[model samples]
Target chain A: MEDEPSSRPAGRPRDPGVAARVLTAVQDLLITNGYAGTTIAAVAQAAGTGKAAVYRRWSGKADLVVAAVLALNAPVSVPDTGSLRDDLVECAMHYARGDERATRVLASLLSEIGHDPQLFDAANRAIGRPPVAALVAVIEQWVRRGAISADVPTELIAGIIPTAAFGSVTLRQRTLDTQTISDLVDHVLLPALTGAHGSSTQLL
Target chain B: MEDEPSSRPAGRPRDPGVAARVLTAVQDLLITNGYAGTTIAAVAQAAGTGKAAVYRRWSGKADLVVAAVLALNAPVSVPDTGSLRDDLVECAMHYARGDERATRVLASLLSEIGHDPQLFDAANRAIGRPPVAALVAVIEQWVRRGAISADVPTELIAGIIPTAAFGSVTLRQRTLDTQTISDLVDHVLLPALTGAHGSSTQLL
Candidate 1:
């Protein structure tokens, strides 16, 4: 572990475990009390750390909540299974099986997003972009192998999997099952990407 | 106009326009302040109406907000286009082009849904169920005509259009355009429903 900065107050060094503990506390508070109710002081107290310690890591509630949610989701390690279909299904499932706590936190955060720009940006940066990035990388590999049509926009290609899963959760409050995930890949995504479904004129 | 009840406090009869005025105010508050910021007092003040007038119209914020969102969306009269794809496209477009105020209100309300059961239920009752009902009815008609396979679950079939639009807005903060909407209907919905373009095993 690195030593405390010379500017640090004369005391025992900060616990390396405090960051994880504080993030856990932040997640619990965000889920239980919501954006308005969660406070730095409350999180600090729950984590058994000082408010300054929490501040040292995250600038404010929006920043803290973003980090907390990211931790809850962990990172989706993109799988390279050679087949674009397999890669896409595995990528989609990462979001389909989001943990309950993360779902609750996100559900609770949705209403606040329109009103708070910072929180929205934080969420998109931490949660939204990573999956898209992973998907894009996978699609690039597929394009290299002449698997997927090169003409298909990577953004649109990347969008179908997560968006399908997202649509299920948003409208039905249900997760994408194994069947739905595969269907989205084979019937919807693969056809769209391969230019084998409907007329190309239909696409954006 | 119906007379006030005999036990009514004698005063000028309730304004014929109060309901519309109050609902408009509720919309403004919901769009501007979000659910937490919008209060009965603020709504009454914005409407230039008395607290009692607002309360008489809506039981609380949840009721008021639901009514406002519903009014903004307006009821979609599912078109009898004789084609399920056309009907689905038309219905999905109704939500895709939601006015700025309605979009803002919905984005704000999304985060609050999990914590407030009353709001969640009210939102579902007014803003959520209508589209589903309309979609189900359309699918039923299609089923009767042998336009779509009977094997496809009505709920899954109904979910695609709106959920696709919803996912677009949620993750990307983008609305579904005419082209994307048409593509989703033609490429995703039609293929899934008709069991064409690929194997039928992929459907929900």
Candidate 2:
């Protein structure tokens, strides 16, 4: 790792494991105490690091919480299964099967996030944009192949699965099951993308 | 007003005005202090009433807040405009233009609601069910008219606009504008319902 010569205090080299420990501490504190309750001092204490070490990595609580939450949701690989339906289904399942602790932390953060603009922006950047980007990439491939229309609002269409998954956890207190994911892809995403309903018998 | 004869303590009949004041106070405190911060005693003080008055009406904080939120979102009348498109658009806009205070309260409650089973159930009944019920009613009307397939997951189709509107306010920090709502209806909702794309030119 490159040293931040200017920012680093002239001393012995930093502990290589501090960052991981601090991040893990942040998640634990967040899940237990929530956004308002989780403090840098508490995180540092839990991580067995100094407050200065935590601050050196992240600016403050918002930054730390956002980083912790982002880490909790490890990015799903964008599937290139040659079928948009399959890709979307895989994407939905990935979100539906997200870590329970992450869901709890996010649920706790939702309130604080609304009140704090900095936290909201940090969350939107760290948590919100990635899946949409992945979905957009998948949809664009179909558009290029002429299998889907060029005029599809790729961004809006891309938001459906992620938004649904979010609502499921944060509001409904459940994850979307496999059958529900398939139904969403075939009925909502597929129909919206292809302009054709899936399984006419299912529709009838 | 029908008195809760069993629950109400023997005293002068309950004041009709106290319920309204308590509810209004609950909204104000929720918006200002968030779920964890707002207490029943605080709400009583803000409303210039006794805690017993607040308790007599609702069991606790969750009930009071849920009632207040429900009151804030005055039920949208289900439109039967003789056109499914018009009806759906009307429903979407109704949610898009929801009370800002209600949105803030909800954003605050989201975290706490996940942890509290009673709050979750009360919120689902008070806040969540009404709009979905309204949308389901409208879609069922169309289904009866044979304009849309009977087998359409009316419940899922009904959920889209409201979910989008909720995500817009809670996550995106803005209401869905007319153009975005229209595009959602034309591109997503309508297609999913009718199995046909809207506007050939728009599709291209």
Candidate 3:
């Protein structure tokens, strides 16, 4: 692949803000007009940048859309609250109260995921994996602390957390409130994680 | 308002199979070309029916798509197997391993839901409401039997079950299998419903 103009810097310095502007433009187009309507030319025009500048960042629409989606979900730091339950709640909250724009982008992306392997992998890596990984880390910590049972499937539990949170958002067509998030953790994840056993029973 | 020809005896009786044919055509277009690509003209052409026939059944694209999605889901009769756990498992399976075409249709509909109120309401009523209702019915049955505590927020629990099932399918980019469905019920739903206590204590 040809080196991106940003890396070479042959002429005047590339605007540092160009990347953010492009991503923002993509988000606006994605939310308002959807995936089919958004395009590189439109994004460049919206961002007030040359098409070359947009290309310097992402290869094409799917890559740019993927980057925009990932930007919507800026890396959530894993919660290390000393207890698995609290940490899991923190992770759930990240998704439960996540950017509405991201949810819109995710819906658009999910529609095409079955048909586009590249888009699917990009989304799975950027949008899907982080929260699950955070949950896994928290559950692993709990396992070490002897709070979670040995037989509990940490991976499945991790996957379920984000799924449940975002699923509600998708179904309701609205962002989840604090009460709903609390219910999700209290009623779903914590019970699944603890298997209704000892030590972690206090949340109930 | 002019009565639809199908409802009246105008000329030849409207073919009894027109509705199914049109719904199937919509599903095909939706799966292959997505929501943006599928159109009324194209659906009518594919279904080998006139535009009037399609319009006679549905008001427009949103209504047509909504009906097609509902058709894919058909009606899942709530299973009553003498235990709340079996009933919940049955409900989960309806979603976890639902028709692939329905999943595709749902993805397409979900993408545009934010912008289209007609599509949103149609989808909410057709695809989103039914499973939650079934789950609520099952949970209510258990509550009556005294198997599940009356204090449980059956509505919230009901929402979570399908949310978790559909969410997993969305995340994985594929339908869940039989074992995964069982695990979801045995490990996730049952534990959450019973709060990991009593007869459902096997998982812990």
> What is the DockQ for all candidates, taken in turn?
0.29, 0.61, 0.48
lDDT of 3 by residue, B38-83 (tens): 9999998898877888887789988888788767655657779886
Candidate 1 - CAPRI tier? acceptable
How well is each residue in A22-99 modelled by candidate 1, as lDDT tens digits?
889988887677777899999988987788787888888778877887676456677898667777777777766645
User: Can you tell me the DockQ of model 2?
Assistant: 0.61
True contacts kept of each: 0.28, 0.68, 0.53
TM-score of chain B of each: 0.78, 0.82, 0.79
On TM-score, the stronger of 2 and 3 is 2
Better of 1 and 3 by lDDT: 3
Candidate 2 chain B weakest lDDT stretch, 10 residues:
B195-204
User: Interface RMSD (C-alpha) of each candidate?
Assistant: 4.3, 1.5, 2.9
Would candidate 3 be rated incorrect, acceptable, medium or high by CAPRI criteria?
acceptable
Interface root-mean-square deviation of model 1 in angstroms is 4.3
Report every candidate's CA lDDT: 0.67, 0.75, 0.71
Could you tell which candidate, 1 or 2, scores higher by DockQ? 2
Structural similarity to truth (TM-score) of each candidate = 0.75, 0.86, 0.84
For model 1, how does the per-residue alpha-carbon lDDT over B75-171 read when each residue is reduced to its tens digit?
6586788656667766767656744344555556766665567666766666667777788888788888997767656765576666656655655
Among residues 3 or more apart in sequence or in different chains, the pairs in candidate 2 whose N, CA or C atoms overlap within 3 Å are none
Q: What is the C-alpha RMSD, rounded to one decimal, of candidate 3? A: 4.9
Q: Ranking under lDDT, best-scoring first?
A: 2, 3, 1
